[model samples]
Target: MGRQNRSRKRRDEMNKIKKARYDAKELIRLKKTLGLLDAEGNEIMKDIADVVDIKTAKEIKRDAKTREQQELIYEHQESLEKGQKVKVTNDKTGVEHVFNSKTLKDQYGNYPAWFKKKKTAKRLRKKQHSQTKNFKQAWTTVNVPL
Candidate 1:
């Protein structure tokens, strides 16, 4: 009877492990669909989960906001460095604004003009500020002669 009980316990443990793996996979898929995973395959959901029990939901919300802001700042800085011209179309206004490297620098101090909108600009500023506080930050710095 003791051996049988031990075998059954092992089987139950295996099943629990399998279930956890399945749940992780499904959560990853859902996070990807929700745009919560970066290109490096880091899952924001996992980060949230790590802090969920210890931290308040409001803190998680703030972290998410900061993460998104940082991503936008990095993307804008990269586009500016690359001297890539971009066309932004406003769905509501149906107006397309073209921004080249020079125009971007002239308008937004090394950031793109499309990013100059009040909402985005505020986020980018916050992101840049946070990044400047941290050491070991690597950014793509490209110089193109126009």
Candidate 2:
């Protein structure tokens, strides 16, 4: 077979293997639900478990990249604490850039204009008339028939 055909055959075989595993798991679940799980099903499950696991190329690459990013971020944080130049990496582009912790205060300086202390809205209470008068005096001044 040609290279392309061989690769396609491999992919199809992988899909079939994945489907078979899924079907086995589903079967086990269904049997358990019906209280019919038996030694045969358990044996099949053990056989499936014994199969060697395969990690995809993309996932392996992603794990390598993540470890590298974590190292970069740690270095950056360490430098900031020691007041040194920090080598920071752009997560998306995987590009590294250096910045002096002492010199960089962001574009808006150390504190932005909008960075004031948070103040909550003042709640206005309902107005009570003649607030200065004592409770007894207030009633005495009010008009009432004997």
Q: List lDDT for all candidates, in order.
A: 0.60, 0.50
**Colliding residue pairs in candidate 1:** none
TM-scores of all candidate predictions against the true structure? 0.26, 0.24
Worst 10 residues of 1 by lDDT: 137-146
Cα deviation of 7 in candidate 1 (Å)? 1.7
Q: What TM-score would you give candidate 2 relative to the actual structure?
A: 0.24
Best by lDDT: 1
After superposing candidate 1 on the true structure, give the runs of residues whose Cα lies further than 4 Å from its correct spot.
1-3, 43-146
Clashes of 2: 0
Give a tens-digit lDDT track for model 2, residues 1-146: 54678889899999999999999989888766554656555532434334446689999877776765555445444544644566656588785656556444333244222434343111101012222233222132123222
RMSD values for the candidates in order, in angstroms, are 17.8, 25.9
User: Runs in model 2 with CA error above 4 Å?
Assistant: 1-53, 83-146
